[model samples]
Target: MLKDLLQTNASFEEELLEEINSLGKIVDFKSNDILIDLNEQIKGMPLLINGAIKILREDYNEGELLLYFLEKGDVCAMTMACCLGKKQSKIRAIAETDGQLIMIPISKMDEWLAKYPSWRKFVFESYNNRLDEMLFAIDNLAFNDMNQRVKNYLLDVATINKGRKIIKTHQEIANELNTSRVVISRILKALENDNILKLHRNEITIL
Candidate 1:
């Protein structure tokens, strides 16, 4: 499974692939599971095999702001920073869906960087990709209104889950968006009246 996933998604060379196969450990996570928490010591970097992970930043009052969603075939650049700097995690990572991870120990980052050109390139590209995503998040929060942000957030959820139906409660969505549950509920009700979506018990179906 690891080798096949690497071949299909990652750009690692055969030699580095062999090393990863030997050194990387496979871990599984279920939906809503906290993969990493604030101030936790960094140990290894995760290479996503399948499903989605939501990366979040902690606010001043112990709240978390959603940074971005990481899909299959992605790595967290912030996680990379933590690993390389030998520091604690500054963000929280939650499994948005059930998934598998191939965890590479921090000790091997420099080794792979020096030994494999493909690994070096992959690391740099991953960093750039994540940086772009975070920047977009910053912009969205800075300029986008709450209503548009809510709608766009639903669209994103649908796209990520590959379906029109999103299995999230208003409070959950509000928490992710760093807003009050009351605000999310009100917006959702208005959107339902607008016929943009149908709200079920705990799911929102985009129309």
Candidate 2:
């Protein structure tokens, strides 16, 4: 679901969905499929219909940072990284499970928007919301303490999944918090010892 603001006057969601139905066929993707790649042309915007997708980026010497976790009914076409005129994807969409998506070319989207003002409003709102979130993440990482940042991230994931058996590793967590793996490991170990959490291979169960 879209977790941010919406323009009151526009029924962008409905119009966008209608546009998707008019485009190319729905495609099935397996886990780890690179739905879009960095520096790749913008072929289409995808509406995730089922399963989950992880949006991320990896640094040369550092690991990946989990930008977002998009699920069913979520749209990924409005981000600047994948906007129609962009030459490359700023982030990667990695399928977390067997999933289905509806892909619509950006060109079609532009055409569709021209005919439907609501669709244009919706895309603009969605893009603004994404930008806000990215800025929020950056601000927090730059200012928040490590412990509080980790706690906040865990809380965020817990809210998303309903409970806290989050299937993630220290390295991943570290990346998300923009910290070191060793630091994350140390913090996680402390939490486990305190019975605040339990850790397995790559999963952490909140106690």
Candidate 3:
């Protein structure tokens, strides 16, 4: 899997691949598994080999808001940050599906940074991309109304699932969006009334 995924990337040269294969270990998680909790110590950086992981931020009130997703071939920038800075994670990472990943030790980060130019480039690029995604999330919350947000959220879910039917309850959507279940139900009902979606028990079908 690593060979197929990393071989095409310009950054992963033969030497780098050898190092990664030798130093990294395979890890797996089931769907909905909490890969990392808020304030947990970062042990290593994870390179996703398959499946998806949802990265979330939690507030003081214990509300979780989606930050971004790490899909196949993507790395968790926040994890990299925590590993390099020796800080605890401020966000939560959960497996969106059963997944496999390669874990690279934090101790070798600096050594790899000095030894491989490609590693530095990959890290910086990942950081910048993640920052952009967070900014987009903030913009959606600050600028969009609840209706628009709900609509966008549904669209995102459909895209992620690659299907028109979303198998989730109103309460589940509310929890992820950090909104009240009542609000989500109202918005979903309104969308249903508008012929935009059909909501049934624990499920929603986009129309």
lDDT of 3 by residue, 143-206 (tens): 9998998888888778777789988889888988999999999999999999999988999999
Please report the TM-score between candidate 2 and the true structure. Answer: 0.78
Per-residue lDDT tens digits of candidate 2, residues 63-124?
66667666765666434335566556767777766788767676776576687776677667
Alpha-carbon lDDT of model 2: 0.69
Report the lDDT tens digits of candidate 1 across residue range 1-207.
556775434467877888888999988999999999999998999999888999999899877788999888889999999999999999999999898888999999988889998888888988999999899898889999999989878988888899999999989999999999999999999999999999999999999
TM-score per candidate, chains pooled: 0.97, 0.78, 0.93
How are the candidates ranked when ordered by TM-score, highest leading? 1, 3, 2
Clashing pairs in 2: none
Against the true structure, candidate 1 reaches a TM-score of 0.97
Q: How far is candidate 1 from the true structure (C-alpha RMSD, Å)?
A: 1.1
Position 140, candidate 1: lDDT = 89
Candidate 2 displacement at residue 190 in angstroms: 1.5
Q: Give candidate 1's error at residue 128 in angstroms.
A: 0.8
Measured by TM-score, the strongest candidate is 1
